[model samples]
Target: MDHYSFFDRDLSWLLFNERILMEAEKETLPVLERVNFLSIFSSNLDEFYRVRIPVLLAVHKLAKRGSSEKEDVLLEAQALIGYQQQKFGKIFTGQLIPLLKQHKVNLLFNEPIPNNIADKVMDYFYSQVMSFLQPIDLADTKKSFFPENNRLYFFISLRTANDLERNVILAIPSNQLPRFYSVSVADEQYILFLDDIIRHNLNKLFKNEVVTGCYSFKITRDAELDLKDEYHGDLSEQIEKQLLKRDMGIATRFLHQPGIPLRTLHFITDKFGLQSSSVVEGGIYHNLKDLMSLPVNNPLLRYTRWAPINSYHVTDEGSLFDHIEKQDYIFHAPYQSYNTILRFFNEAATDASVDEISVTLYRVASDSRIVNALISAANNGKKVRVMVELKARFDEANNIKWAKKMKAAGVDIIYSDKALKVHAKIALVKRQVNGRDKYSGLLATGNFNESTAAFYTDHIMMTANPLLLREMELLFMFLAKGKKSAEGYPVDFKHLLVAQFNLQSRFMELIDQEIANAKQGLPAAITIKLNNLEERKLIGKLYEASQAGVKINMIVRSICCLIPGVKGMSEHINIRRIVDRYLEHGRIFVFENNGDQKVFMGSADWMNRNIYRRIEVCFPVYDEKIKAEVMQLISLQLQDNVQAVNLDTALQNIRIEPKPPLIQAQRGIYEFLKAKSDN
Candidate 1:
């Protein structure tokens, strides 16, 4: 672990965000999709300030302020962020606006409102926006003032009687109103931001005063919640309290309009406790994450939608249980349907012989059919148990809400222990078939939420294997009653790799097997696809395999610390990342053991938290057909050059020189599955 170099984790994440920005800058992509990329980039940067900046600030503050590694990181991040912001502005103002205008879609920014549309804009403003406006005096002596997180406000300069000037903060009505105001004028269409409409009506608000200048600004606050050590008190209660405290946490970044007067900026900064961090000068529009909601409804200007591919494995519309019982079935999401799993739960809920249901809910959709099916199962006199992980960040409130509803519906709700987050995705259905208890189980690399299944490429395994189901039953029991009710919960996992006990060791042993195979002059190769790869010891093991001449291909989507292609350390290691129509979210580890390959997929990423902190599960792919499907999917991804980028040691995305008959992996997989279905 010590001999080699590693990329800084936060910086690596910044590079990933930069790749998203690069997507926005790609001329080949559709303009509207590029705008969506811009929104994703903007939101990503906001989170960087919200979450990562706080940690960096804490490190910088406790050390020598002038010269620290954290300070250098902040400076570097600012530079990179500044560059990206400038690019975003150029793309927005210079390129996208003109292109949309060419298509007769007018998105007017900093342009004079033509005579035809001014009246409608004012009428809409008076009716809809005027009531939402709340202008506050910056010089109020009654109370102290500070900006809230991520909301847009205007720092305005106004002139009153006797030539006296006043500074005010105009809270833009974007919260209660749409960010864009679209209207058609005869043959021309106009779209305006809510900021400018208010800007146009500034004189109306200031009756006796002269409107001077108006500029936009927003604040990004530190959003990382601190959970106390487990032995303190009730974990859920503590989490609720911490969520409230998050609003009052330290402000990390102050983003302001570029042309604001020095006096106004100073007045605003001094009134609030925003003197510590550097202020970033930005455009009149602050939260451009709203760009995701661009109101153009033309299909010609957007990416063509593709219908989700069907599961060829489930050939007929027979019982899902029958299909899985015939052989193990693996479902690839987005490219394949999620309804089969939904049917599994619905059938379990409605089937007359079904007796019990168990599931782990990490993050469910707001209108989750899964939870509804579970509630129905409980109402039908079936034993239903749900392990809701309330510590899922940004999702705690929703999970808590669902948990209360499920608890009220006569379902058994077991909250996750504060010491370990149950991040594994698994569901068990116990049924009495012919008076003998039979088990059907589901395991996946993603959440059970159907919303993300439309865009996140994840793997789900439907298995009727008795051994795996028995182990899963033990896991549920252990989760419900930790350490006390189970005899060998932590020590003895052979088929499934659980995080607290066997995940890291099993992966290490697998890597060692590959290394031994290579040393013995046999075929040794590995392909791993994961969201992140940062655990130092496992990375070190990969490095060892590299030195032993075992070829490794890693498709890491984000925050990869391993420096691949380094001589004498990781020469045999190569890493590429695919950022495309679908998020590469599934975790797969394929090892070539001389000729017979071994495939395993699961929820656990090769990160410290996933390995040592959370309760995760990685299960082996035993069925030959399902194993081949998983391998085929991985092989398609490896052949992909249209969306794949080779991640070099400098962390730059060097485009892979695509082979002939260029393969876009997601499309190829869809076609492959479709052909299989046809056959």
Candidate 2:
């Protein structure tokens, strides 16, 4: 409870994953959706180890300045992950299994196939699965062979012709084949894991050698790309070179099935040269993250679908730009269709009055309609410029491909700055309104990727404001010139809060104003909705605001370091984390300016990278109706009892105090918007 102390970001992230696990543990939800949550949890941990574990290990090997703090954090993260995996096991076996049986979708794990479907499964093994699998003998191979990262493998204990025990590894081709095999036998239906199918047919895999036992295991390698801090060459080329060597990075986690003979374990470790800490004991079947493709088409066993509804702007006739000029509109995504945002680009591409289009692409969908529109606009002879960030971790290749395509289409492709990443989501379309050039653009709290926009909560503002649009034009010019020309780039802005220059200072000033108001006995409050909050200065400022009696509420989806509700230190602050059907991704900052409230939404979180290393934007909600809409949305999220967990002093995601009426914020937003559209 000491003042100025913060939670470790990695550990806080584990608590967030734990919240996702809790969703899988819920008995009320349909078994399929619960399975989806389980898949999400497992996948989240997989990426965590892939991306973060190497960074910690690098402090010793790469940085050569290894600290005990990093070591301690790795240990803590691993221990928590181990504990959660145990819980996951129990949920899958104890809860999920029985529920599956109740629904007649028997998802068999490592257990043997039933007598009725045994023949059918054997037929599938020979016809489909057997052709793809080829086991490699670990003891017989001369050199150490590396397995593909995160792939499911069967570690077999075989008795050779000499009556000696030999261990071999056979990969489960879940990548090429489906993980779950559905077998329909007469009146009942069954789902079997590919692990079990391989396990039952081990004799067929090794015809000459006698198979004794089969167990599942997987390995996770360090997936961090260590691009040189100072790269004078092409960023895309360096990243591509590193990406090819990703599988060869340090082995972070070596997870094997529990109770594998010590001799086999030792042979496996010695072959791979794995450290003691790298080895982790897992359950029967590895890589349950494949549960996402359960392949069941039953609607009754899934959450009732709530389709995204179109708002008034999309349905309104005439140009999309004209509507924005008349009034600033916000697209509350998934609750409202992302099609409107897509329509903006489509209309801009075809509009004869529009002559120039510019935007920043951080992470776009694989099949992006927005990109298609930009291509169309460029082909139509309009000046289209795109500043594409090629450093969007795991998405570098896709962005590069799009960049090449856009460049070939006569569009100006802008690479990122050498030292900084462009993370802002903004698009500008300049059109001649009565021979006077005006701008219609969008400022969003998330990526322009329509695929993620379906579920990731974000605020996209469509406006034709002269001041904001002019600044956006200047920003595109600044980005187009690359890093060296940023001197006279007009970094100082009065309307849009730009990161690396004004965002942090402006936020601190706002917090200071709240503190002053609180000291003057005026109504002072601040509400923040973001994905992460790990910035030290901002967290310290929040501590100051809490001491000054400004009430604060936060809805952080992941990685919250600031502990709340502590006596005398953070008594006036409370934080809520909501994990529901849709991701809580919008970053809304609401400050009570006495009786008048000011709202801002943006891409930047209160994190170090977002505040300093990247270019971000936070725009104000000026329209009264839009402001009220955001206020109500945040209020609904704050009031959510279901799917909302209170981040306790010990960093535990404890259940909120339940009341009679329940409020799930994602559902609330959808219903609120749908009701408005109906009216």
Candidate 3:
């Protein structure tokens, strides 16, 4: 183990983001799509600051005086990020902006407002933007203003009549107003940043003073909610209280535009108590995630929309339950219609036979139709029990809001303990048929949120498998107890690999089986796809299997700590990462038992939190047809040369160069599903 090495998780994550930035550099993609990739990269970096940077800061602080490893990692992360930010700016200005100009669209990136649109910009600023502006005099110590996390602000330096200097902070109300303003002048489109609009209008606000400098900046704070295991209050209420305080957490990154005087920068830093933060000098504009909302709506500048195919078409006469009861079905999201999933809940809500409904809601949509269906089921006199994870990061408020609504509608709401979260995306529907209980269920690899389903590539299986549903039912019953641990409930989960009980052990056993087979001179292999792979124990097992001559291929979308393709350790293992139009989010695990293959898919990533803390369900694929389809999809992704890149041991995303007939997995999956639907 001492000889073996693993990539640092944060550095690996930065490499994943670099993959996204690489997408923006592709000359073949649509310009708007490239802009979108840029937006995603920026947004992902903001989240890293809000989440991971705080941990790194804590690690750096706690390291002993003689130890430099922690500090070195922190500095390396900062340097890599600085390099990526420079590359981001170049791609935006050098490539994307010029491409937009060729299409007769001018996106004003760090440029002055042209004379043609000056009047309109002024009029719009005066009428709309001025109302949201709140300027704080930084000189006034009594006022004490705290900047919210990730909210844009302008640090204004002013000189008065007596040459007395005054510094002020003006909040850019991007939350209250649009981040960009678009105006058309004589058949040409011009897009303006709201920051620039307010910059141009600084004189209108400060009449008697000379505005010396205005630089845009934002503070990204740690987003971890403080939850005590022994907390006695209602978990949802406690989470709501913490959500308000989340933005006020310790600042991790202080990003400001360059050219601020050193004296003023120190003064501002001390003033905001950002002494411990990593101060990054950035471009003129902050929060370029607003580039996603650029007012250019040309169809040619975007990826041609592929309408979701109807995978499981339920005839109007027959219900979704009827189809599931006959045979199991799988739906690939964004490529396959999510309506069948909706109809599963919709029919369960109204069906006369359904007597009870159970589900686990992690991160729900704001206006979730599935929650509405659960509320309807409760109102329709069915027993509805929902385990809503109040600890879903950044989505605590929305989940709490829906939980209260469902509880008000007489639905039984169960909240997981503060120490654990229910991350399983599963739903169970029980019906009374001929004096016996019949169960139909949905187990998915992603959240049951329709909004994300439109763009996140995931897999959902609708099944009437009694064994799996029975195990799921037992798990829900255990969840109803709301205990902090899964120890006392002694139900053996044979069909479903549930975290905190059998998930890690069962996966170890599966890998061990492959290792044994490989040792016996039999054919053995493993394939897995996940959003992240960071758990060390399982990674060690994979390494052991690789040493045993078991072939392993993995597609990890982000944060892979396992150093693949190493000599004498993981020489047989290869990892690929795919980043494209849709977010690749489904988790699939396959192991070859000599000639027979076993497949499993669910919400669990091989991360520390998923293995030891969260309640996750990874169920085996029992149906041969569905298993074949899942294998085929994984095969397509493995064959992808266009969007897939091999994640080298050095943490670089090495592009798999195009062969003769290049295959992009997302596009190929859509076409395959479309052809399947056509047949």
Candidate 4:
């Protein structure tokens, strides 16, 4: 058991998805809420096939440079996903469907529609949905219809009146129509997928032909759009062109009904050039993730919504930066109001004394107040520089749109170089107070998108620390001026760990200190909560510390490759994942550091892209109270028996080494924090 070796990355990611499925299976959750989790699982797996599995398969086929482990990684990933998909199916149709019925919310398939409801459904379809419905005959035209990315399609099997057997694929007009068609029938409100509405009306679609049963199916194509540098004249133009061609990216998974006739399957597969036997056989309907949009007005059917609570400063006192100058304030979002951060931007935009504002946009919301603030600042004669990453996955188009808008408003917009993405969430504001130039900055663990700010548990730190502020100014200079020399920026950061120089080394130094302390038989330990932990070097360092008897606890929300609890190998390492109310985002790294307990929180995870390839900032928790708060969160997550899954030596996702009474950590933490504020 070499310290450098660990579990395969893809297999570990599958284990993380299994943890999400486990949350959906928790009986304590309300029925419809469980349904939401199932939809999320289905959606997540669809992405896994489209993005991840294809990459692994491609590497295995090409045996790209130095990927000797590619074939084995792919095989292990296939096995793990196959097993998890089986479990996902059981949870969805077996548990979720029956449970929905228990709440009088029935998701029916081919169940005879009552006359009154069928009439209403027909009327609704004719008025609203019929205009958009365009059913293509697959038999007449051997021409294949490619389903749009993540869109639903129905395969219609028909026997002609002349005894000519044929199969036709109908594109369910779900993109134009509402996914859920609600009808009031027999005093029950039934929600039907739009696919069902088309299924009920097959006769109307195939005017002259006799109709047979319609089986619902969908195909998830490789969504990764490759903008080849040699082929693409312009990066933005190539990306835009590929966005249209993304539907045609090599087909990864042909998800279909289990009972599709052999002939139909062969014809479809051959037409689509699908040579693999990895066709996923699902139940009648595919893409039930659309059920997430189902209209169920019952408040009890969803998780109890909590409006973002205010921090001690904003709720008790009005001014944000005023308190920031006195002491650095840490804000945890989705729990703490993100509006406060918005207020910071809003104030900066309107302040007459503020001279400049700079921010990096990785992913901005469609209607972003942050963008609007930048525009307002530029309009007010302030130097507003925005570095928007145009290569953000699936978000390139939105970012391009906003970049143009911001540029039109006089913002000095800087798009990233094609090779690297600027993922750092940073905002620097320069103001003049009493004829002295003062600097304030906001460092965030998530995007500037307000939409996700409600569902993603992230942290934003507001500080007036001249040391950090000056270093941030240097970072912006590096982005704008492209200075290679260390002296071009304020390089001395005693508090912050900025990538490109000290982040990786500082992390190793912290881990080595823990290992040395453990070797000395001191109280040495480390705890990390991050979104991803796939970088081999970081994992190896942790393993080294673990082997040296340093206790390690990690609560990684996704893509963990390290195998924990292996005897004499990783015996002191433990890993758990929490999938609950809000997304377990926000990267927090804690080091025992010879029992002084150094803690840092930031936007960057331990992934290769985050640590080296992007400009990220991991800031220290100078405020002891906030450090304790974050530490408490890691402690609760590690202790969580419910809504948390533990990874074993074999990389099996076992639900937290079960104890008598389980602690559902996320809920417990919420209660714990809310109670603290109340006290």
Lowest summed lDDT over 10 consecutive residues: which window, candidate 3? 63-72
Q: Taking the candidates one at a time, how many backbone clashes does each contain?
A: 0, 0, 0, 0
Local distance difference test, each candidate:
0.86, 0.86, 0.92, 0.79
Kindly state the number of residue pairs that clash in model 2: 0
**What is residue 513's positional error in candidate 3, in angstroms?**
0.6
Over 1-679, each residue of candidate 1 has an lDDT whose tens digit, in order, gives 6687777778888888877877777788888988898898888888889988887766667555555543346667778788889988998998988888888889989777778898999899889888888788867887566677888888888889879989888889788899999998765668999998999888888899998888888988888778866456766677888888886778898899888788878877888878876599988788899999988887887778878766666755766777777788888898888888888899999988789999999989989999999999999999999999989978987888888899999999987666678899999999887889888999999999999999999999999999899989988988888442223555477799888878898888988999999999999999999998888899999999999999999999989989999999998999988888788899999989888998889999988889877889988999998888888898988988888898898787888876798998988988888788778
lDDT of 4 by residue, 1-679 (tens): 2436666667777777777777778898887778788788778888888888787767776665665654547776777777877787788778887777777777765576667677888888778777876666765565557666666777777777787767776777777778887765555678777777877887876777777656666777788777674663656677788888888777777888778778878877886677753577776677767767878888888878876665555553645566678887777778777777888889889988789999999989999998999899889999999989888988989988888889999998876666567888889998888999988889888988899998898888888988888878877887896443333465666667877768888899999999899999898999998899888888888888988999998888888878788777688888877788889888999998876899988888888888767777888877788788888877877778777877777766677566867777767776766777677
Between prediction 3 and prediction 4, which has the larger lDDT?
Answer: 3
lDDT of 3 by residue, 546-591 (tens): 9999999999999999999999999999999999899999999999
Pairs in steric clash, model 4: none
lDDT of 1 at 247: 68
TM-score of each: 0.96, 0.96, 0.98, 0.93
The reply for model 4, stretches above 4 Å from the true place, is 1-3, 62-67, 138-144, 157-167, 230-235, 315-319, 482-494, 657-662
Name the candidate that leads on TM-score. Answer: 3
The clash tally of candidate 3 reads 0
Candidate 1 off by > 4 Å: 63-72, 230-234, 315-318, 482-491
